[model samples]
Target: MSRTIRALAIVLGLTMLVAGCGSSSGDSASSSASSDGKFTVGFIYVGPKDDFGYNQAAYEASVAMEKAVPGVKVLQAENVPETAESEATMQNMIDKGAKVIFATSYGHYEFAKNMAEKNPGVTFVHQGGLKGDTKLDNLGTYFGTVYEPVYLAGIAAGSVTKSDKLGYVYAFPIPQTLANINAFTLGAQSVKPGIKVITIATGSWCDPSVQSQSVKTLLDQDVDVITQHQDCTKTIIEATEAAGAYSIGYHADASSLAPKGWVTGSEWNWTPLYTDIVKTVKDGTFKGSKYDGDFRVGLQTGDNPFVQSKYGSMVTDDTKALIEKAKKSFEDGGSPFAGPVEDQDGKVIYAKGKQPTYAEVETMKFFVKGVVGKIG
Candidate 1:
């Protein structure tokens, strides 16, 4: 989920049947020991394995795990939709000897939790979810607070925009997307006041055509800088190159996609978390715990690997200096959403000049002062 420099949940309540009251010790005993010699891990994707976006990053981590660990067997199912299919698919993997299961979709949370119960011995992990009380001791949830990097990208896009009007092509109106949009707008306004971030949601994660249309529509309306949360870079590359505008990419390093028009992006680096989990399991110290793929553990430059590629020498030294300063601040534990937020409908979500609390930022559901367009 890339575009120019413009900008841009929890339910708990569930339980593992095998985790408590109704579980049979026989089932739990069977799960505790693996008859297979190899470490078998399975992953399910919400999109294609090679979408060049979010799924790609997860796939890359899985691939690295395969190479790093000896006697490891990796299994993956791609193009999995967010429906009943998730539960069935996960069950099939678990039945097929998967010791560690990574369900990599927001919609797969319930399925992963349920499947974790049926297979109490197997460790189940999901991305983009909160741990519920009824959750299996083996089930874990995680998501990256990459909005911090997205904010930095917005600063770059804001500096590059000549019209001060930016475009954001988004996918879905979920809390995650909304937070990114708000953070991007705030980051831009921090650098360039009175800047407006116009947003458009395509209701899809990996539709290139929809993303392309979203970008074209925004560019046609005279937006000079663009950023997106969709899954492809083709649209951003095309729009910015055609309109001679600047853009910041998302999900992956997209400077190569628009060498002449692109700035930096907020890409996911899932290696650190993946590596740590794998190491934990290998060392027999696996506690079946929850993992937070947030700024504290997942967005590391060395391990999580978000990058800001140069905009083909188009970036002035002053601009570079500002970005470097922001980067340093972020590295020093400053928050991108440290303030005064609002929703898409202009409601005072966080109040004037007050930084949003941690819970408020994670549960954000609105646009900021200058983000134009509907939340859809």
Candidate 2:
């Protein structure tokens, strides 16, 4: 589709563009963010900036990049749902002279992909979404080895879990979340044999009422520790703490909210990567740049952009040592889902001495052997 045609569709859809600090108001005044002038970058989020979860981390990174790059401006629109509204937001930013756009939600990929095709002059990068067969120069996906820290947190969960049952409250059965749940389960199993993890899918990234009910169900099942792959996590963590269960977090730290039941969690530090992308785009090097494809950083890459939080008081020094040892191994090129891994049906998945590549891991479709849930 042509850019002009797409713009007309957006206008007819009556989609609204949020105007904020550093934002545009649908006026066609020439953009300072043009390639030759003051570069402007746009970021659209799927939730409130202060959710203290996924969006918060991305929002903070956007602000950091804005400051890191001198003479560059940033446009931010929060609370952007994953629907066609996202397409409108992209068009608005493009009109405002944004040469690079960060679509910071998984569900935003389709719209971002469409926009990337329509606007070859602009660069679009997405977070946590897999790159499809369309090999566009201006489109890419980037993420950290998020499952690495989750595995570390799982070690803590396993160390302290009294009933050998760890509960996972996740957004979906997608490979990324599946990898986290599998890593968490495997990490716990490494510490405590015969450990079992119960999995429940909330299906929505930031639903509180559904998360609260999942916690109650897990608590009733005598699960002692709970962790999640959800976006807005306060409801689940707070619910877990209220029920006297240990909680592990994702996206951002909720340690303050679960003082008594808090375990160490994983968080995003996107400065290095985000800044690098902005610089590349601003320099007109984004087309053939390293960020031009499925860019993933892990321990071996030296900075995964995701790391573990400080350990809770309940974690033992011995457990911390073990986590560090595993981390070192990962830095030396070990994977959480290493060889000898099996599916829930006892069928071998990754045979001994054979490992799954990052590509294989990204398409993960089965529950690990000890997980107690169905993935469809």
- Candidate 1 — which residues are off by over 4 angstroms? 1-36, 206-210, 288-311, 342-347, 351-359
Candidate of highest lDDT: 2
TM-score (all chains, Cα) for each model: 0.81, 0.87
lDDT of 1 by residue, 1-376 (tens): 1233222201111245334443221122123223567787888887767878888989998889888877777777776667776777766666767778888888888888888778888887788776646635677776666677777778877888888888988878877788889778888888887899989888776677777777778888889888888777766667677777777877877776676787767777777677777666656556643342222332333343444544545667787778778777766666676545556566766655566544566676667788887763
TM for candidate 2 is 0.87
Q: Residue 228, candidate 2: how far off, in angstroms?
A: 1.4
Q: For each predicted model, how many residue pairs clash, with residues at least 3 apart or on different chains?
A: 16, 0
lDDT tens digits by residue: candidate 2, 1-376: 6999999988856544424432332232234546656788898887777878778889899899889998788888777778887888889888878888999888999999999999999999999887866789999999888889999888999999999999999988989889999999999999996999999999898789999999999988899999988877888988999988999988887799999999899999998899999999888888777788888888988778898987789999999999999999899999998879999999999999887878888889988889999998
